[model samples]
Target: MLQSVELASTSADVLIMAAAVSDWKPSDVSQQKIKKDG
Candidate 1:
């Protein structure tokens, strides 16, 4: 169950849902940046 739809209603065989108010959950996520270690 992976939900987040609407790229022109997914080629029109509908089962639509809304409200995915996005920022994709970003609160300074880092695996390869923000470095200050010397």
Candidate 2:
């Protein structure tokens, strides 16, 4: 994402981001890989 933003700044005059960001931290993180259930 950093590389993308840096590259875009060269050609574009302005950059507008409309993505939503989470302010809160997660309580628990899973160490194991999540399996896709089919």
Candidate 3:
């Protein structure tokens, strides 16, 4: 969130940021589909 605010404060006309966020994967890969609680 701080990064986003700092980005807007940038004086540069062209800002190129290649920020990559990795997805959170389960500890184990299950062949069966996971169930959700109601």
Candidate 4:
């Protein structure tokens, strides 16, 4: 499973678990919109 939450309000242990949790994230993220410039 995956979750997203604010980091500041969370306790240390909870943040630890969130950090250690594993998920399939994309290998690359684009900084800007992709354009089909051919």
Compare the candidates by TM-score and give the number of the best one: 2
lDDT of 2 by residue, 2-38 (tens): 8989987988988887755675566887899879999
Top lDDT model: 2
Q: Arrange candidates by lDDT, highest first: which order?
A: 2, 3, 1, 4
Compared with the true structure, what per-residue lDDT tens digits does model 4 show for residues 11-33? 54554443434655768989999
Instruction: Give the range where candidate 3 is weakest over 10 consecutive residues by summed lDDT.
Output: 15-24
Clashing pairs in 3: none
- Give the RMSD in angstroms, all C-alphas superposed, for model 1: 8.5
What is candidate 3's CA lDDT for residue 38? 100
Pairs with steric clashes in candidate 2:
none
RMSD to the true structure for each prediction, in A, is: 8.5, 9.7, 5.9, 9.4
On residues 1-38, what C-alpha lDDT tens digit does candidate 3 reach at each position? 77886878687777555654664566899899989999
> What is the clash count for each candidate, in the order shown?
0, 0, 0, 0
Per-residue error at 26 for model 3, in Å? 2.8
